[model samples]
Target: MASTLKAVGRNVLFGLLMAAAFPIALAAQPSHPSQKVTVLKVNNGQEVLVEINGEGRAVRLACIQAPLEQQQPWANQARTALSNALPQGSVVEMELRARDVYGRVVARLLKEKIDIASPLISRGHVFAYDGYLGRCDDLNYPRLERQAQRSKAGLWAVEGGVSRPWDLIEASGRQTQP
Candidate 1:
């Protein structure tokens, strides 16, 4: 009985130590800080050059894939839509995610507290990027895409939506994720 009581006391002490250390460990870890950035240019439907912390950074919109330049009219339309949404000099909150191989910051952008990708996806200007949707609302994005298809909005106005940018990239022998 004494040995059991000693073991229980050790376990409780260990638990208290871990509980106290956890917050300290979390505080030491680097955090992704959201910053207000000014839009410098819209590179495409899903990418923008923005000025953040006084440096110009290229940021790709997370969780949505836009029509590629080679996709013609749809591509231009998507770009125009994005440009309208984030015109030069407009400020947006940028939530940084991962950086891509091309040195672009993959991020979610918000204006007026509304997620920019949500509107773009709902409008059918872009598709819900399936493979690279970590930390995004995967279910809602696809649902919005489906709704756009049903309503025949933007790219979905055609019999079938434009070919996915990834598909075209693959056909062109590029293995990079867009």
Candidate 2:
């Protein structure tokens, strides 16, 4: 019993040491570490799972709303278009913004010197999400969204128009509420 207790204490100490060392190690890494990632798969219109130097992480495009799957009219199309735009295996420079509730990194990606979100937005594959406007300081965001709305691009071409994902989610919540 004494030997077991000693072993357990050593294990706890080791765990604490590792836990404390982790942040120090992470902080030692370069600020704004060059995040070169390869798109492994499109999780949704607004998110992708990427591999950066063999580490995988979820990256949610900042300041954008892609249709939820059931939102239809263009949910799959949005994902497909985004996938085509950020072809699998293509390397991109990800500018980190913040992390979402789902623990996904929020970032704007650049591919071939072009903002990855631009074509997607201009083509109406996604909406300029205004919920977290403070983090979305992109000036072209609203203009591109408006252009898509006016030009009847992508889902905007659907009859009665496409619903924003956040709105759809809110509506769903209301419906489900007592």
Candidate 3:
């Protein structure tokens, strides 16, 4: 009986060691952020509704948070802006930050050398998602964002200026008027 108990203990230790190895190996792998995805939809800002390959999953645009559909001056405009940014055959490079509760890829998207997320913020089409603002890591987004706001660029052109994407998501699903 004692010998059997000792064997079980050894197996548990081996199992724990094996489990630990997987994550470390995965982490060691380079962050191949970009994926071959098609633009399925584009909300205001850089929030693109995309269809990812491999899993063929539809996910919200990663990184910066764009205004919701109804909140924009023209709900369609929100989509149009993103559509213009990422046209058909556009392949985005996404640095997978994490997966939200819904399993969507929350990432910092890129197009060539341009950091896609920053442009959305600086362009005033989207805001730094307050939930994970993270100091606007790559770009000096705040300064550019200010310029966009002052100029009333894109979504900022609305009446009261702009509203946070999170606020729009949180508020009743009503569109904001200019």
Clashes of each: 0, 0, 3
Name the best candidate (by TM-score).
Answer: 1
Q: After superposition, how far is residue 106 of candidate 1 from its true place, in Å?
A: 0.5
lDDT ranking from best to worst?
Answer: 1, 2, 3
Put down candidate 2 lDDT per residue, 1-178, tens digits, no spaces: 9999999999999999999999999877545434778989888788899996688898988888888878775778788888888888999999887777667888888898688888888898888875553577544788898898899998788877787777777867754200
Candidate 3 local lDDT, 129-174, one digit each (tens): 5345242344455666778888887778778876675676556675
Who is ahead in lDDT, 2 or 3?
Answer: 2
Against the reference, the lDDT scores of all candidates come to 0.86, 0.81, 0.62
- Residue pairs in collision within model 2: none
Candidate with the greatest lDDT versus the true structure: 1
TM-score of each: 0.78, 0.74, 0.61
Candidate 3 minimal-lDDT segment of 10 residues: 130-139
Candidate 3 segments whose C-alpha is farther than 4 A from its true place:
1-46, 49-53, 133-136, 168-178
lDDT of 1: 0.86
Off by over 4 Å in 1: 1-32, 137-139, 175-177
